[model samples]
Target chain A: MSNLVQTITQSRIWRSFFRHGWPDNPLDRSLVMTSNIFFHLHPVKVNRKSLRATYTFGLGVMAVILFLELTLTGMLLMFYYAPTVERAYTNIVALQTQTPYGQLLRNLHRWGAHLMVLVVVLHMARVFYTGAYKPPREFNWVLGVGLLLLTLGASFTGYLLPWDQLSFWAITVGTSVAGYAPVLGSTAKAYLLGGPEVGQEALTRFYALHVMLIPLGIALITSVHIWRVRKDGGLAANDDR
Target chain B: MTNIPTRTPFSKSSGKTYTLVELVHRAPAQMIDHGPENTVFAFPVVALLELLLTLSVSAVLLFMSLTINAPLEEIANPNQTTDPAKAPWYFMGLQEMLEHGHPTLMAVVIPTILVLFTLAIPYIDNDRQGSGRWFTSERGKRIARNTAIYALLVMPAFILLDNSFPPRELLRGVVPDFVAQTLIPGTIMAAIVIAPLLVLRRSKPNAREVVLTLFTLMFVSAIVFTLTGFLFRGPGFELYWPWNMPDGYNPFMNL
Candidate 1:
């Protein structure tokens, strides 16, 4: 088994695929992080203190995981959904009852949206309580707040996609709150709903935001948020001891 | 300008290996006041931990998705509004706030100010003394706990009191609209938020302590408002016990 693994690793194709050798040695391990895009968000070394489960409760990472889950399930849901006042509700019914595992898909997306909002809030609380937002990380915290808002946006836009009475009324109420703003209120509400009320135009706009605009913003901002973590010296816990 | 001689590995005259030397003694790599380096490579350890977290979170989400299906109510009807007509669960806090005062103040102004204040916290408390420590110190933790307790008691009381005798309604003819709707409720909320900071001023609290007090107040108050708006509000958007919600209106369905 070892020989087979070595042979494959030594092959040109495998070497080209992974620039580093097996990550058993220090040099290869460092290369593994620096060379890979996904792993590059992390530093080559992390302080032992930061790894404690109690310190972070892993809420930030859980938020990211939930985001990925939402993205996947959301894409699948899109395959069965259409953003129209007439068909949106029926499409949801069909998704739940007709499509295979469609109910589970919608369920995961729905629950994940709620969970992401929750975990992001908890993560912010954890950061604040731990003082992780202190110097050099202050901007990261700001970005995180931006990300939190984006998460809310993503979830809110998705909320109207179901087109049921729950979504319709919830959105009507939500957007009306925006209309309470002083000068730009009505304009913002009209822009959001594509009119004075939730209708086909609102559905189209929300669909665009839920699937494209907000998720893209989240993806881009999340990258910056994690990259800033590495640049700002891993976790704030590194300064504890 | 004349060029300065650059050091070389080999000497021209001797045609032999040469060296560039310095006479000064440099400081060693170690330094005082620096603690022992305690760290681990991120590749295996962090990667493994993240993998474990992802799997566990996914499992929990899957279990939840399987057991409790997401709510899908009747078709959209513009003419017939839901009893409460609440926002998404996350925005329920803001909606609840709207019940207390004018929509502009309760929904827009206060929430906007809170968001801006939250974003400004790190800048406001820029001292680097206790970056990683939970609640900064013993005093900070005590302040946070007390502030939380205070908010826990005060916010619910405020909610219930304000609900029972809403200034917006009770003082409608007694006082000006601005005073009744905006000023009264606004002043009360400001007092609730600022009372702890006023108390902390006597002790000459550090920036961290002050932030702890303020954040705890805000965080706990948000919880109170959200819980009230979500679980407690029932038909006609009126406050009620969660289990006793009228017309079979389950708040969880709003999720």
Candidate 2:
């Protein structure tokens, strides 16, 4: 018993146990690690044929990583960023100059948003090319399409938060585009902006949308997307073999 | 005996040959693979890789956001509209269409049709043959690739043309209604979409070949459309790129 206790204490087994399985074989350890919920976001296998589909290839996953980055950076930014247009630009300037690595945060958010839009389009194209939109996978594809739009919505809402001349009218143009919905055009613009012309109300509306409504939508649909990918029976199978 | 017994035929005596049934379904090569036959996927290398990738992008973005700032400006100005009054770059394609006509066809009508068509594809084709390869059967792959190529090439020029559309002030003041909606969409659709499709069908080309031709036509159409827009700048000369804004160009000129 003493020997066993001494072995347990001397072996550094606990550290390895957490990171890898006790058996000490690399494959065994990998299996154990992957089975753990904290590490299982990745699948144990991937389909090689569908793997190289050019429409997206690595881009979809890249975008998702960017979104995760956005969430974190956006949170950090929220600590410093003021929504008012008067303070907004100044805050951005402060973030860039005063805060450590603030400019990097801003760039990441900006570029990430743009990249996400591109990635979503590519993801859709990949899905289309691979014919992953067929049958059991159909509902998931539609859900993916929704997620794409939601990502776009997130980008749009985030754009308005800055209140720059470029951001402002870009959003205004976007809202006006929304207003083109026949009878809803005028009223919708009013509703969307929360009044005529983008002002304080528009900022607040966009803030709520960026932080609350759209993120929630993304989370909900993302959950459904993952579940569907699994429920549709792992990765899409190849008909060729 | 003319063949002179070319083979050393010992199979009947030794019973070396298998039955016909043994040669068919029992073949290991043709069997279905169920479950995780791949240990490589279960390997440590890929498991570490995905984690690394996910972590890196997130970390880099975090570093960037903290260092850089997102855009901000003075505030909203209803009295002042920006020059170009541009949509997001993604929507630039539709905007280009708006110049050819009005908002109705490009924004509402066409987008709705495309979305509906996208949604309807699985239902429209009951065949479950093509899942991984381009030509699941033969016809489907052709249509898919052609459509993709067409969308890719035509889309950019369409956006450029949209970049040239007059702002609301210009619209409210000068351009005719007939010119805005009907003439532009109608003409462009005919020249780029309908005419090419008609030509392909008339030639009785293979579906894949036709789609390829269509994409080619699409590419040509974009070049022509963009060039025409460039040549006819009219008063909207301020809306050219650097995509975001141009130097010395006053957007408020329209307002």
Candidate 3:
């Protein structure tokens, strides 16, 4: 049995699948992390202070996790939802009452979105209060502010999907604020709503933005954001100066 | 027992070529005083923590989804508007700000300034000394705490006082629309934000400390305005106790 196991483990196919052997030793452990794309964002070795629960309270991790959850649940919801003035509300009603576990999926997406916004805000507060945004981490902080705005954009766009009165008026009131801008106010508002007010054009635009554009921007920016965190020498908790 | 060779090929004693270049007196290049003993391999440790967090957060969200249904009101009708047509909860701060001053100032200018200021913070306070520690020092902690409390007390007072005795209403035709809606409210809001800094200015605060005051004040004021808009306001967009909203209006139903 041992001989057969060793033979399989040393085979070229197995080696191709995993670059490193069992990660029981230091060299293999380092290879296990540095060799994997997902793990490469993390350093092979992390400062113990940076890992302490109280230092970060895991808020950044929570935000990322919430984003992933929102994406998952949102993808599931897309199967049932259609962005149109007529079918949108009806589809939502059918989704809740007809489709299996559909209401649950919608609920997860909704709550997860709200939670992501809240968590992202709290994460910013944590970074600020910890003085983590100082010095070398400046660009990452700016990226984070961008992420916050994108988060708001993502949530606001998703708000209009159901074509319900709540979403309609909410978005109308929301976009009217954009119309209060100096020169580009009315033009920007017109572009956003696709006309004078919320209609099928607005729904279609918000659908593309909420599903494709904003999430893509978030994912791209988030990749760079986390990469910058590692490049900036892990969390500020690792710093002694 | 047979005698074994002490100097193995890879052993230090059998070194064929080696060099001791130069000795430098400084902390390590990447890590300051930290050594191997102060760190851990990120493989299983960090990865497992992340997995555990993912599972727990998913579980909590599942529970919430099972119990609470997301709100879906009547179908869109351009003619029939809701009594209090408010924005999403997050934008409630901007909506509430619209109540206080000119749309140009409240919705566009002030928020624009705040966002730009937020982005400019690290550059403005480019001090590298207090990067890791919370509140940087005891003085920073006190400043943050005091600023938060001051915002908590003063912002609501401003909102309430402004709501009751609106300058636009009182000075109708007596003052220019710009003065009543824009200049007066703008100056008052700026003064409220700057008062704490002026008080701290006597002691000559560092950049980090100054930014700390400004950020805390804005953050707290944001929360106050959001709550006021989301919970306190009711139909006709008038102030009421959150629980005492008339016409059976539940602010939470909007969520």
Top TM-score: which candidate number?
3
lDDT of 3 at B171: 97
What lDDT tens digits, residue by residue, belong to model 3 across residues B1-255? 234455544446533344333343343334644656888999889999999888988998889889999999999999999989999999999999999999999999999999999999999998788878899999999999999999999999999999999999999899999999999999999899879989999999999999999999999999999999999999999999998999999998888
CA lDDT for candidate 3: 0.92
> Taking the candidates one at a time, how many backbone clashes does each contain?
0, 28, 0
TM-score of chain B of each: 0.86, 0.52, 0.90
Q: How would the candidate models be sorted by DockQ, starting from the highest?
A: 3, 1, 2
What is the Cα-based lDDT of residue B44 in candidate 3? 87
TM-score of predicted chain A against the true chain A, for each candidate: 0.97, 0.83, 0.96
TM-score of 3: 0.94
lDDT of 3 by residue, A47-104 (tens): 8889888889888999999998888888888888899998999999999999998888
Clashing pairs in 3: none
**Docking level of model 1:** medium
Model 2 agreement with the true structure over A29-111: per-residue lDDT tens digits:
56664767744654555444434435236555676677776787788889998888678777887887899877777787787
Off by over 4 Å in 1: B1-36
